[model samples]
Target: MATTMDHYDGFRTFSWFADFVGLPIDQVNFVLTQFTALILAGLFRSSLSPIAATPAARHVYGLIIGLALGYFCFGRQAIHLASLPALCYVAMRTQNPRNMQRVVLAIALIYLSCIHFQRQIYDYGSYTLDITGPLMVITQKVTSLAYSIHDGLTRREEELTPMQRHQAVQKIPTTLEYFSYIFHFQALMAGPIIFYRDYMDFIYGHHLPGSKSLTIFYDKNSQEKEIVLEPSPTLVVVKKVVASLACAIVFITFISDFPIQRVKEDEFLKNTSMLYKMWYLMLTTMLSRFKYYHAWLFADAICNNSGLGFSGYDERGKPKWDLTSNVDVYKFETSLNLRDSIESWNKGTNLWLRSIMYERAGRNKVLFTYALSAFWHGFYPGYYLTFASGAFFTVAARSVRRHIRPLFLESQRKKTFYDILTFITTRIVMAYMTFSFILLEFMPSIKVYLYLYMFPHLLGLIAIILPPRLGLSKKAHKQSAEIDLSETISNGNAHKTM
Candidate 1:
């Protein structure tokens, strides 16, 4: 009983519901698709257990559902989504085995960059959810899988890192398996970038906690032979669902009031006080994070609900379900160091960049990885500005922590005061960096930086330049005792806090 329409509207014709929800139809469509995926995840766990559903049937089901969701969200543009992955799969199977990884990486980046270029030309500054989001995720999956396959097939065991060894794909997957890994309904739309090995393990029920598929010791008397059952994901999924709704609520309530674009307006620049401007910058950026938090938490919940994200049990025997988590909410909010803050957010991208670029880059890994990150984000001038600044900022932050943090370890009181100062400094610096990232234009970002006097950049440069001139390295041994004592106290405090 489907109604005929003159054109394929990407399931974006829900104006009545949009009006009721007080959001654009496109956003409504995206939210509905996510919620629909959540529902399907529940059904996947309850009804399509490995005992009930064969691997082939599961693969076909996922491929069909994922493609339907793609078309329903992006219409004809979604064809690129399927075709790009299919092309990569073919290349992986037929291309020169020695160069498969490099070839696939080039193809994925080129295709994604072309889409980004087209988007910039056609729909610049529009915040509409589109095929590009999916393209970015697909690119990550395609490239990572290619690298893992190469590691498995081309490299010797001693050459591979422990993680690379575990995740490497020894055998070329069947077409069904490959498509299902990429287009699985739970992770297809937005991913935490599941590795090919992890996805295959999940599909085969090998990912379940305490599953007997991978026995470590054959000895019956072994202490590690105790059986532990898989735990239900109900509590974790419920918690994540609640967290997502809360983030969405905060976003809906505060996003309009603290619009980042307002900082660019003449009215705000002229009328707003400096203190108010600083406050607005921090608040707006903080609000901006909720959107990502909501998306990632919801996606993680979807994966967990389908029994995919189990890591193992904790020491207290509570199951840990964060294998696919993309954000560390507490550390993200409370970190006193820029490095920790950056690592806490968009964690999947950080891991992917570390694995695919940083580890492989022989020299200047940070610069290369940051450059690659900016490129992967697209051709936005503001992205380059932010990442370029980020590269320096990271180096500066690292240098400061090494040279200055030990100086504050003379007493617990001094350490606490230092933490307070750094917490505020880090937040302001993060907000300042994020301002350019959000604006996404050269002139606007530069204008805002000019408005703020561009002090963070100056401070970061000073942080980098002043340390060597001051001979901080010569004084390292003098502070070693204090640093050791401070570490002892901090570990005790951390245990107490936990």
Candidate 2:
């Protein structure tokens, strides 16, 4: 059996299963796509490691994740995930950890789990609804709002500017450099889904308030390494240039071997060599980070292909005067893992999703939380059931955590090989749960149904790995209510005055 990859959900953002469903047409339907786009953007930001961690980094991560959501909900489904944000009270309720907060949080999680399970039944298992039909009136409003900021929000285009061209001309073949911006079809499929806050930091970050001071934000007088987007028309040209180069690179590399469809078990055993299979799977796992970057880079290149050194930050925390992160945009590419994932991709919409949907769902009402997630993914029965199942299992896992923390603590004190073994085993199990949705996406059988039926098994499975609860008292979540308004402000450029 092939080992599963990391962030495989990127592929699932726009599920192939949705292909067997209907496609939305017309201005009304098209406009409605924005809701889900917004929600994906929202969730992408919401589900990240907050911006202290560098809002720009987290926002960029959100944007990457948002691209997938936009591809799924806006690009595919008529129902926009953000359209029903008002209904997603659980997603936003993170700060209020009241009495018995853990229990409340768990319950909310369960509710969300159930709802998400329903999505598996509905969206994934071939049930389709124009869902936009019922929300036409609301969508009309969304249509208007979308128009005002849609171009600014999605920020399309990928090509370099005259200076970028000159730089390229100075380096290698001009034609090859220009070609890099267009062929990344993967990016065209959806969006740049960058975090609003991180984008903000990349721009007006120097002027930012609070801890981002030169003493803290940077010691240099010229935090000029920052990539402040040109407020003028030049940005469009720059993006086009950068996008063109990135596209050209991907066309030569990725499109040549676009593994569009997944391999079935039997076909894999017979046709591909073990080494090749290992390589492919490794690519799948590692490329999740790349897949994210490719989408964003194309969008960014499209925005910044202009040859001006308006401002830019290399993937490192360092700002570049005009540095090249790519030797070829192929041989030298930054591969972002989970940590980086949270940093770079932010969408404006996820703030609401987290501040609204997932956060609102408490430790007690996980079912509602799953319900909200299911609704976001789709109104399909399979999606609802599958997601809910995941939530139920998540709850069970929490119970297991209650049991495990103490023992894990005791074990941590000893600092033995057993701790390493236990830690790895725990993480592996977590990883499996993380990608369970990916597995369900392809399997399409009663066995998948069976897994859904045993959704609680997630709890059981986790407990099997985690130590049993030792009656540990729950401490108030100190992380709650600590709003870095300045940091939050810096997360998204669109939101700031830049």
Candidate 3:
């Protein structure tokens, strides 16, 4: 045990900085390496432009930098990062073309699951940084790439969705390019999970806002023309960085005061007023969310600085740099329904769940997606609890919107009131659900929910059991057809029947 401890301790070259910052060495390294990547992103576009002047150059540069950063941050364990992806690439090359998606997904998920299992057993409930973080990101990248490749190779273009067609990989990437995409420093740590096709486009400069292939215009004379516009990411990067800093500040300020573990304490659970417990849950969960917001925003800024996240110009002709944005702060915080809230938070992973899992499911896509999400997250009992709760909440939220929301939509004042009501309700629901997610243990999660009277779960059950007709008369149901409850669900794959 001492030898093993020394082996792990050998990776602690940054112990001085860790000590100075009053954080674990691994965490200090995670943040410091990202700061290093951010600085490198600027240099890659400016002083190091020549090194990244061509697609091949860019691939090599990213691979080298990413590998170095991974090793520096994770030491010998970092080898696991490249090995899994390389094995998956080999599977893609050798596996039956039709089974490629299943094969690769299994390999990635199973490999990641083993690591997750080891982590859980080794340091149960600890939040210590490990190679598992990058492995999770890599699993998404490789599995999504597998599905996209299968779509391109086996499925007919006519049968594919427009987004699928756009993302499908027509040709298998060269080994170097595949590794580069897998290891790209911009997203390797905490990703928004860029698609293989999109990453290639970014590398080749084919999807820049100013790229002719991406944007076009018509002249006043009505002649066909291309409108080229230069888009700078300075504003987007600045705003995201500032927002991330604010999130970091809020997290640092309140995390210790309202740690999620407080709810599980025997004294608090046994003595605290239910109302105060609810408030505590809300505050702590919100603070926990800020940690993700900070990391995702910083990762996004790195992508923008490296000229990789430019999507296109908006209606007002301002550039939109959200191609790889993981979260939308406004929509995420203010979402009035489960569908919108789920879509807003962890936007990339939601997209992956939609395209890769839900869209491909034969039936019960919602349940299947949730199950796959729970599995992908880890073997944690609390993860399963959270996702199971989310599935129920999804059904209830949908029913409420379909039945109750239309009654309020008829009047603007009522609509405003409805929005306000749903906003508060959604936050509370999210807090309740996220409480388990933070605790990440079966007994603690169950204990807290039990203390809270499990009201949210019961509410979901009640909402689901009560028929839509109970909340809406036949005439009102007919009248509310125009309400378009389906519109709330993103990606057009919203399960309409259930």
Alpha-carbon RMSD to native, per candidate: 5.3, 17.4, 4.4
For candidate 3, lDDT tens digit of each residue in 338-434?
7778877887888788778877789787899998888888888889889998888988987887777777877899999999988888999999987
User: How do all the candidates rank in terms of lDDT, highest first?
Assistant: 3, 1, 2
| Number of the top TM-score candidate | 3
Error of 1 at 225 (Å): 14
Q: How many backbone clashes does candidate 3 have?
A: 0
* RMSD over all Cα atoms, model 1: 5.3
Candidate 1: which stretches are off by over 4 Å? Answer: 1-9, 209-228, 473-498
TM-score of each: 0.90, 0.37, 0.92
Where model 2 places Cα greater than 4 Å from the true spot, the runs are 1-289, 297-350, 359-366, 379-386, 400-402, 410-498
For residues 1-498, what per-residue lDDT tens digits would candidate 1 score against the true structure? Answer: 112222324675676787776677677778888898888888887788665688787777777888888888889888889888888998999987678988998999999999899888877876777788888889999898998989889999889766678878887889888888888888877778888888877776678665433334435566554333457899999999999999999999999999999988989887877678888999999998998999999999999998889988788777889989988888989999887788778777877787688768898888899998999999989888888888878888866776777777778999999999999999988888777788888998887777778788888889888865776554664685455468557643121000
Number of backbone collisions per candidate: 0, 162, 0
Which 10 consecutive positions of candidate 3 have the poorest summed lDDT?
Answer: 1-10
The local lDDT score (0 to 100) that residue 255 gets in candidate 3 is 97
Q: Report the candidate with higher TM-score, 1 versus 2.
A: 1
